[model samples]
Target chain A: MKKNLKWAAIFGSVLLVCLGVIIFGQFSHGTTSAEIYVDGKLYKVIDDLERQKFQSLRVETEHGYNIICYELGKIWVSESDCANQTCKKYGKASLVGETIICAPHKLVIKIVGTDYDKADVTT
Target chain B: MRNNTTVQKIALIGVLTALSLGIYAVEAQIPVSNIGGIKLGLANVVTLCAMMFAGRLAACCVLGIRIVLAAAFYGTFVSFMFSLVGGVLACAVMCLLIGLFDRKQLWVVSVFGAIAHNTGQLIVAAVISGTGSVLSLAPYLAISAILTGILTGLTAQRLWFSPLKRFRITQTRDGK
Candidate 1:
């Protein structure tokens, strides 16, 4: 029984450390761009090049459609045709490496880290 | 175990399966704030309890039936696939842990089981969506697993002393 407690404590500490890393990583990864993928392929990149304060795109295909909206540094699915609406429920994602995935539609919208946040805008 | 007649074994398995399915149904309705796909995994209590009291095969039977029936009743084909992979992985990990650790350490088994289940689901999600970004969500899922696993494991431990414990099928043949 004592040995079990010791193991539990060790596992608990490891999990706590992992949680700390994930939470810290989520908040700190400076995101300057968002990437959208459909059916495992890259579809679009949203950055300063778009020049819109707020923009919405209707991603459509034979499977379905999702209306993705983005502003400044954050992105989210404003509308979708999927039954569960998980994408919409995921709300806004702004942190670097954060993602909103719609499994039914095979769509993934992710906020990606970028070192060239400005040079990309110029080119 | 050989102590339990085939008829008794069948009856116990049926009851546990039904209970697990019912718990799963109830669990689905309770939403986790912010996280869409995350669940408390309360139904794991039944699986853990079965593994401890009944035999491994009986626990596997209960887990299998619960996954298949739940998916058939309330899930899509894709969801069923996720459940099958996750449930099988979780059960396998739990079974292995149960053998390695003392019976009093069931919570450890439950914790690892939950982590295995989440990993399986995350892999399936990544494959289906074709995004490695899904892997980023692992830490959150792991946190949930630790809490939920402890809860379900303690619940099972509490249940081990209930009148229902009589259904335990002890190994008599080879003491395996």
Candidate 2:
């Protein structure tokens, strides 16, 4: 019975993860808008109002790098002068539990909900 | 067989704890993939070693001391609780599961450890935040855990079988 329980727990966890991926994928399907900025100046506006509600703002720096930001969340440099492209691969972060960071570029992308004072995992 | 002296036991635990802290600090300095709290978890190597060498109780003691010391050194007591609960639960699960496998199956143990660690942390986060939304990141964390676990486990397997395997004085029958 104990052995069965362990296997059951493992399978149950895996199943829940699959379900979560599907649900999150759907939640990210709504059209959202984003504003791109370079050096603290407005560069472009990705007006994809028909895209996902959690639209990501992608900024290409003058140094041939990209910074991504979620319209409903925080801003982070997705790519920069680093051999390891860990940040760029992180893609877009929109949920309260999501984050994007470029340590070399000191770029941080975070998600801030309507209630900033709420007890968030980010804190 | 000669048992470890009190001084030797304390020293061993202390050294293991220090090594764990060093791994934590070093990993903190590196800017890895930011999936949010996804870490190399190098300190876990030490925890795994402790479980292999000492008994499960000793492993738990070392983990408890390491978490408390790490929290006091770097973050707050609240953060310490998160690490303590997560590390202890993960290590316990990993040790128990690994008992079923031989040395060749160290990778399996590593994978279990990483998954357990993430699960423990997520549970704590859910409780602290009072919301289940943080549970959304479980998939991402699981994927990362598997990847890192394989790497760390391979390394650990090699370390365990190496000629310099002076850590374990009295190996468990299952360890063979």
DockQ per model, Cα: 0.48, 0.12
> lDDT per residue, candidate 1, A97-123, as tens digits?
567888889998876665554555667
Cα DockQ of the candidate 1 complex: 0.48
Off by over 4 Å in 2: A1-28, A32-123, B1-8, B171-176
Model 2: residue A95 alpha-carbon error in angstroms: 7.7
Q: In candidate 1, which residue pairs get closer than 3 Å at backbone N, Cα or C atoms, i.e. clash?
A: none
CA error at residue B136 for candidate 1, angstroms = 1.5
Worst 10 residues of 1 chain B by lDDT: B29-38
Alpha-carbon deviation at A43 in model 1, angstroms: 1.8
Tens digit of per-residue lDDT, candidate 1, span B50-129 = 88777789999999999989988888777787888999999999988898977677788898898899899889889999
Residue pairs clashing, model 2: A30-A51, A30-A52, A30-A53, A31-A51, A32-A52, A74-A110, A75-A109
For model 2, residues B79-116, the per-residue Cα lDDT tens digits are 56568777977888886987896676776687788888
